[model samples]
Every structure is written in structure tokens, then in C-alpha cells.
Target: MISTKRVFTSSPFMMLICGSLILALALGFRQSFGIFLKPMSLDLGYSRETFAFALALQNLVWGITQPFTGWLADKYGASKALLIGALAYMLGLFFMAKSTTPLGLMLSAGVLIGIGLGGSSFAVVFGALGRAFDPSKRSLVLGIAGAGASFGMFAMLPYGQFLLNSMGWFGALIVLSITCILMFPLSLGLKEKKIPLKEKRDTRAALTEAFHHRDFWLLGLGFSVCGFQVVFILTHFAAFIQDHNLPLTIAANALAIIGFSNMLGSCLAGYLGGKYPKPYLLSLIFFLRAIVITIFIFCPISQTSVYIFSAAIGLIWLGTVPLTNGVLASVFGVQYLSTLSGIVFVMHQMGSFTGGWLGGMLFDRTGSYQIIWITAIFLSILAALCYLPIQEKPLNVLKATMQPIDKA
Candidate 1:
């Protein structure tokens, strides 16, 4: 017989470690793409806008696929999805090495990698984790898992830079393809527990019901803003730093600082998410981002100030993932968390698509990123206000349907 006490603690810890590692590999490799922008553009004779559009397409495709990927994770299991994602991710990297034209980069880096990320990223991985842990421990586990991305960002940025310098971009991509293979081992630990056939049917019904609710739309809209802010910074920050006449190392270090600080931020956000209202926590995060960006723009540009802004911004970075997922759990039961969260993530990716592409377009047109930073700050404030009216309660339809009807 399975021991109830042992099941609660030990299994979850094992899952956490394994999940974190997989996340590290998946996110770390993708996060390093910014380092390739200049080199790839120079070699291929493509404009920065062309590269940006491909990356934008990547984000858009990922966003478009996320809901389907989430549904697959919810219906089947994360292991199968993750395994498929890993293979696709590796193949994308391999093809990226051989990419010679804009179209080649679009298919390899944009579509394939985007699909790979949609299937393999936190939407699938943490969705599984969300189901594994109870509500009490869910936020904490999600936070730690989210931190894995930050860890990847921290380690991979400089490592990617080194690879670029030592080996050419193609060689660096080959190395990353091998690194993507590591996710396969991590996938082995994510086993799905069997649900009763009746429960499975009800879960599907619940998901359908959630789609009819207005709150879900609001939640998705707010999540899109989070995606926009993060992707914009991640894809463009390195270029932005370089534009300022700062050393490339400064950009690398800045990305690393964001990753390093995000570890603490994600953990803290997770802890607080478990204890507080997730919507409010999300609002606070957005509000703080506005403040951080404002200060970053107004302050003098120096290595010290850049690092400080990056760290401060990083602390709030991806902290939204835990809370956003937490809110989904609060509204919809964990049974369909992956699918529902995936839909929300799709909206987030829409924002990501805009941010990545627009940052480049604006820069190319104005020869300045100043306008984009200002726009982000304004949107952050608007997003903070958007969360104010969200009711933390579950959808009324769910409560009504789940409760037994009274007999006359």
C-alpha cells in the first residue's frame, strides 16, 4: 500500500528537482538567442528588423500553439509532450546552424523552436507540477520551477557569448542542440497518476464550462501584458545595451543579473502567492515594473546603474508565472489547470510577439529604444489597474454545477 505521508513530501521534492533541471535546459538555451542576433544578421546580410521579425514570429507561433500543447498535457500527460518538445527543440537548433537565409531562419528558429517551446516550457512542465502538489504547496513548487528558467538565463547568457566568441554561431548552435537532449532524462520523472474515468469526463466538462466564463478572458488579457514586458526585454535588452555604447559584456552581465535576481523574486512571489490574493500580487508586480523602468530610463547609464536596474527588474521577472498559474488554479480546479493555463499563456505570447517585433521596428525607425521603454512603463501601469477588479473566487458556474441541488 502507498503511504499517504510519504507520498505528500518525498515524491513532490523529487519532481521539483527533476522539473527544475528540465526547465533549466529548455529555457537556458532559448534565452541565449539574443546573443546571436548581431552575428547572425551580419553574416546573412539581413537587417536587424528581419531577425526581429523571425523572433517575433517565434513568439507568435509559440503563443498560438500553447493552448493546444496545454490541452495535450492535460489530456495525455506532460512526459509525452515534453519528449516531443525536446526532439523538436533539438532539431530546430540543428537546422538553425544550417540556416542561410531569412526564410530558413524563420522555419528553423521561429516556427520549430516556437512550437518546441510551446510544448516544453513552463506551461506544460509547471502545469504538471501544479497537478502533482496540493494547493498549499503548489505556489512554492511553481516558484522553484520558475526559478529554473532564471538559473538557465544566468548561466547560459555568458556561456553562449563565450561559445559565440570561441566557436562560430553555427558551432555554438550545435553545442546547444546537444544541451537540448538533456531534457529527455528529466522527462522520465514526470509520471502521470491515473484518474478515474468518471473524473476525467467531469474534468473535460469543467474545461468546457470555463471557456464560457468572462473572467477567463480578463485573466488572459492581463497575462498578455506580462508576456509583452518579459519577451521585449529578453529579446531586445542586449541590443539596447549595445546601442548605448556599453561593452557587450555589460549586456551579458545585465541578462545574468536579471536571471540571478529572478531566482529570489520567483521564490518570494511563490511564497506570497500561497498566502495572499494572486491578482493583487500580480498587480503589485506590474506596478513595481513600471517603477523600475521609469528609474532605469531617468537615471544615468553606467555599469553599476545598469546592473542595479537589471537586478531590480529581474526580481519581478517571471514572478508573474507562478501567480498567473495560481490564479488559474483558484478559478478552475487543478484537473484542467494545464489546458486553462495554456490558453492564458497563448495570450501572453501574443503580447510577446508584439514586444519582440515592435521593439526592433521602433528602433529601426527612430534609431532609439527610448520610446519602447516609455510605452512599456505606461502599459505596466495600465496592467496594474486591470487586475484591480478581478474577483479571486472560482467561476460561479463551477460552484453551482459542482454543488448538489436541494430536493423540494
Candidate 2:
């Protein structure tokens, strides 16, 4: 018989490996959806806006379900939640393969896959990693796990395009379904952490308290911008490149560049989060994004410009995940991390919803993505400003109440 203690207290390296594998599988399948948009629209005679709406719905649904999924992951543990998520994700892909109408696509891609992603993506996996490691090493481990998503995008996005070219969109969906299902076996390696039956605080109260905290709101708002930037790029960057009269391979290569650079970005962010103030680092990232986007938009459109822009943006891509979660742990503590982080992620998803759909809608209406790019640049500036004023002190209700008295 295997030892339960050993499972619960596995080495950080072992935990990182398991978490990374799960993240790579979940994110790999999720990233491939972007590659399907144009092909699916052409085959089904759907407009870009129609597909955009479905992807938007997927983001919204994912956002709405994240809090609940995180709550479940916190209460029951990540293993079972991940398993169920994998099953749902696979089914969604299968159903997406059969979709002939926009409604069917919405149901499969938007609702089903959204819920699946909510339960299995970074939120759940990072929460598990957070629990398994000590505070000192948590950010590094989380960073490593977060890179799995970037690696997924690097590997799977091109692979998805290849699959589409080889087998067409329908066959690609079937293949993706098989790939998503593989997450199940990897999830089995994740052991559930034991929670005491009666805790000092219940999940509901924790969420309630987190909501009332001003800092949580700031974090949520800041995170929303991250979501908007990432989702907009992920959903439309390839198409945007194609619109510039560039080859599809150029678009694909740009995405791959982002993924490649993001690997280093995530690792560096993790190391920095361990030593510096996470919020300040986040502020710097947002500020730099604004500058980068502004420069890219104004610069002449060329293959070289695309590569430079992609590499710059990719470096900051998922770097937000580590700092965001690290801040949550720093302020709120790990006891309620999954739930609290879920709530923050809901805001992120809301931004994602807007970013994905709005980019498509604006393009359809104006025949240009320039406006959306400008909006992203503006929001990045705003996010940087917002982070500048945030106080990164720990959450201590008693200490907060005693502050004036202590000062007196």
C-alpha cells in the first residue's frame, strides 16, 4: 500500500513536475481553440462576430464558474475537480466537432469548455501547488507551473494549425478531444490535501471577508486588465497578423515566439516575487506593456515588427499569474487561496470576455483592430496606475483596528 503521508508531503520538485504536466495538458488543449476560429467560420458560414461571441461566452462562462470551481477545489481538493474538468473538456471538444450552427458551438465551446477550463486551468493547478510547497518556495514553484501554459501555447498552437491543415477542423477537434482526455491520467498523480472538518473560518466567510477588503478589489481590477490583454492577443493575434497581408505561418510563428519568451518571463517573475514586492513588479509589467503596445501599433507593420512585438508581449504574458497568486497569498494567506484567487480570476475572465468579443465586434464593425489595440494600451496604463497606490500589507483585521491606537 502507498503511504498517504508521502503523497501529501511529496518533494517540491515532484509536485512541480506533476503540476506542470497537468497545466501543460489543460492549457495545450485550450490554446488550440484559437487556431480553429477561421477554419470553423469558413466551413460553417459563420461570421467572425459569431465565432467571437461563442469564444466570448466561453470566457464569460469560465469566469462565472471559476469561483465555484475554486471553492470546490479548496474544500474537496484539486484532484477530483481536475478529473471532472478533464472529462467535461473532452466532451466539449467532441461536441464542438459536431457543431453545425453557432448555438451548438456556443453550447460546446462556450459553456462546456468554459466550465472545464475554469475547473482545470491555472487557478486550480496553482492552488494545488501553493498548498504543496512552503511559503519560501511557493512563488518559484507557481512560476514553473505557470510556464506550462506558455509551453503549451508554444507547442500546441502550431500543432493545432498543422492538425487543421492535415485533417481539417473536424478531425482536429477529435484529435484535441483525445489530447484533453489525457489530462485524466496526469491528474491521478495529484494527491488531495487533508482539511480538518471544523476550521476557524468557513469558505463562505472567507469569501465574504475577502470581498469586503479594499485590497482584494484592487487586485481584482488589476487582474482584469491582465485578462483583457492576454485574451485579446490569444484570440485575435493570429488573425490580426493575417489581416496585415502576412502569411499564416508568420502569425503562427509570432504566437510561438510569445510562448517561448513567456517561459523565461514566468520563471523570472517567480524569482522576483520571492524577493521583491509583487505589486510593484506587476506595476512595472503593466507599464511596460503599455509602452510596448504603443510602439508596436505605431511602428510600420512588417514581419520583423510582428516578431519584435510578439517577443516583447510574450515575455510578460503569463508572468502575471505568479505575482497575482503570490499577492493573494501575501495578503490573504493560503488557507483560502483557491477561493479568493478564484474570485479575483472571475474579474480576469470578465475582462477576457470583453477582450475576446469586443475585439471581434470592433473588427467586424470598423474593419480594423486598431481601436482595440489602442484600448489595450490605455488599459495597461490604467492598470499600472492602479497598482501604484495599492498597499501590500498582510490582512490582519485585529492589527488594522489597533493601528490608530498603536499610533496614539
Assess every candidate by TM-score. Answer: 0.93, 0.94
Candidate 2 lDDT score at position 121: 84
What's the CA error at residue 112 for candidate 1, in Å? Answer: 0.5
**Candidate lDDT values, in order:** 0.83, 0.83
Residues 279-397, candidate 1, lDDT per residue (tens digit)? 89989999999999999989888888899999999999989998888888878767667778888888998998898899889989999888989989988998898887766677655
Give lDDT: candidate 2, residue 45: 97
Per-residue C-alpha lDDT of model 2 across residues 1-408, encoded as one tens digit per residue: 111211254565776787787777777777667767787898899888888888888888888888888778777777777888888889988999999998999999999999888888877878778877899999888888888878988888888889888999999888988888678877766666673434466676667667666667778898999989888888888888888999878888888888889988999899998998898999999999999999999998899999999899888889999999998887777766877888899999999999999998999999999999999999998998888766666778523742222212
Pairs that collide, model 2: none
State candidate 1's TM-score. 0.93
| Clashes by residue pair, model 1 | none
Quality of model 1 by C-alpha lDDT: 0.83
